[model samples]
Target: MQGSTHGIPIDTDKSSPIIVDLIYRLKIRDVMTSTILSCRPEQTMQDAQKLMKDNSITGVPVMVERRLVGIVSMDDVINALMTGTMGQPIEKHMSRQVIVLEDDMPLSFGISWLDKYRYGRFPVLNAKKELVGIITSRDIIVTLLLEMNKEIERFEEATSHREASTSGFHLEYTTRRFDFEMAGRLSTETKRQLKERDLPPKIIRRVAVAAYELEMNQVVHSAGGTVRVVYDGNQGRVEILAQDTGPGIPDVESALSEGFSTATEWVRSLGFGAGMGLPNTQRVSDAFSIESSPAGTCVKVTIATEERSNP
Candidate 1:
């Protein structure tokens, strides 16, 4: 960081950890400008200069057909102007010893190359060694700033989620048909959320069980649905809702009955569709309701925690 190539001001030791991660995580292709203005080697240096001027760029890569052969920078144009050589062909005046960056390299590598060479820009090549784009210090800075802002937003949103568990909060998630892999995610999330609160273990277990059963119901029984949890901190209650676009349950009574299941053979083979999902959810809840139709089915369950507000 101390003896960096040049122009790049990032010091890994002192910069935010998030920024350091970004430099390493982002690839050259992610930051470089894919839409590039290039010049044929046979074109006049004046032509490259005009391209730079019109585009407000400091450098341009010189290409021979599709191959990148050289680059002309602002200094090159200035020298040509001072020496009255602007009309000379690019191939004759362009710096032929071009330093290039590969599209797959990390942004950290680009930062190093830019500082190491102190060049205005670097030609970007693909795995096939084809010229694809170009990179500059400005691009790295702008992209890092943009990505850092996004990370900050995510961090803030997570903090808000933790806070919402104490206040009145409603969280919703989409569940897919037969997505057994994700079946317990909402329940696990519920456990994690309640564990941070002052609620008793019995109350927490009831909420987690209700969440898991409802989430599993959507994954195994419903075509697909949304699972929602609303915590009424003032009333010391947690409400869980499973609403599904459905062919509708033929027997709502059978669905609520213990040891009753409509799940197919394949679902049962996966150790699901035990017919206990709705029963378990309803057993753990202080309030329960179910509505079914050809259009959809919605089940709501509420767990009453201790009569206390969040600390």
Candidate 2:
């Protein structure tokens, strides 16, 4: 899917949509196994391998004085054995350049890194850069599954209170300038409201993405804005309206294209502007329209309440 926040477009990956939602909200500490088994750099390669074998694990973090220094995996062990270096210190053969996750980082960040490196597991570090735990892809999958179950339960509960009429609901939120701290707050609230109304998971996911992208746009590029969500139960649809008083997008066509961005270097550094936001919003919404001028920009997105099957 594609969408633009400001002039930057957003793109969604081809992974499972439900899984993406789950991972995007979860922090590493929420899913990581804190009771980690690690090895010291001074430990013999033989000892590290034995520990891994005994625990049925394939990798272990190498530490020095309680701080992470490197990592040793089964591949390292095999190479050591072949080269007759099993007797050497693990530090000698361990991967010195380690890629670690912070405990508070979102699972989505970890997922991206994992996809890039195809690592079996990652060492998780705390604010002090000390190894605190470890996480594997299996852990992420299991956690997401559990979260999905909770969402299902919430849906059931919400549906139990469903009204006979499809009158639906409406909500409005104000966005602030340079409010990076609360960029996605409006979107999160919108998702909560949709869940309370027992909207389908697919619908909720799309609305959430669009709302978030718009919210980010207001915070990152606009002076301020308002996000409004209007759901029509009778029509089985939800519409999102985002209006901002920022300098309007000069080139709407260019803004919709993938990889097109007008964000400053600082915004790019913070990972906010990659030019995929509006395109992603358009991709997920059943209908999308926008109007822009020097005065302001307004975006409207509509999504169906139910998934449509392929003919």
Candidate 3:
């Protein structure tokens, strides 16, 4: 549970700029934004516009009698006014069915919400009918990207700075071109690395699941891929890069669907391509990102030492 940034020790007592990444680990309760600006459900469209401008935000949660009833955004106000209905009540246009996240949920869950929903922001609430804070898409992106870069730097530091232990084990493998045989080899190397590092049982399982799905994606869909495993100090982490030069998935949205598949009959006979590889990768990896195009696809997955408890 020790957290720091850029080799600088972080103080647990004070709120500082770097405190975000550290406080994020302690628990969501401590880092929530408590001072929220809310509006009434029956407020006028003009009222919402002024509130948004005053707060420099695009939306505000609508609370009736201190209870969150809906969310009113600038868009809702504009839509109301643009139709020559400036005098209309805000409730007519406000989104009553608001999506909320509990204060205890990890920042990782916010990633899934942003990816799955069209809203650019979210309302954070506590168990006792209290608005704790707002967790926006930008916040989630910044936290994850920072954490991912931190991990990459940590890996580079360990590989270049510290000397390998005399009694330790080392195994490296490189993969080129996409083929069925190569998939099995990558999987084997992954299990071998987990065994050698003696990583925590929970982390090992998550890494294995993510690796299996990623390798299969490259073998069945992409042009080529690479897998590497290294032991760094007392903990272990796995990094996998899968790249391919085939006609990339034209529609990432469709590909991420639960039962959508582009695999041919030959590939399907192997019990592969239930259209769950990418989605499952998203579900399993602690940090997952995708950059894809018609020319190729590149996917990166990382496993950290920190354990996540799901509700």
- Most accurate candidate by lDDT: 1
Give candidate 1's TM-score.
0.52
Candidate 2 per-residue lDDT, tens place, 1-311, comes to: 24311221124455556555666678999999999898899899999999999999999998878888899999999999999999999999999988899999877776777777778899999999888899998888888778997787577546633632345777677889877876786677678778878888888999999999998888777889999888888888889999999689999999999889888888889898899988988999899999999889999999988776962
Give candidate 3's whole-model lDDT. Answer: 0.68
The clash count for each model shown is 3, 18, 1
Q: Tell me the tens digit of each residue's lDDT in model 3 across 1-311.
A: 23432323344335454445443563444434567888887788888888888878898988877688889887887888789776777888889888988888755345456666768778888888577787775565565566666766467546733454642323334444446755655455556556565667677677677777877887777666555445444544556666666568888888877789988888899889889988988787767778888888877776665564752
Q: TM-score-based ranking, best first? A: 1, 2, 3
lDDT of all predictions: 0.85, 0.84, 0.68
- Which has the higher TM-score value, candidate number 1 or candidate number 3? 1
RMSD of 3: 18.5
Where does candidate 2 have its weakest 10-residue lDDT segment?
1-10
Write the residue-wise lDDT of candidate 1 on 162-205 in tens digits.
67845567667789988987778677767766776767899989
> Model 2's lDDT to the true fold?
0.84
Error of 1 at 49 (Å): 1.5
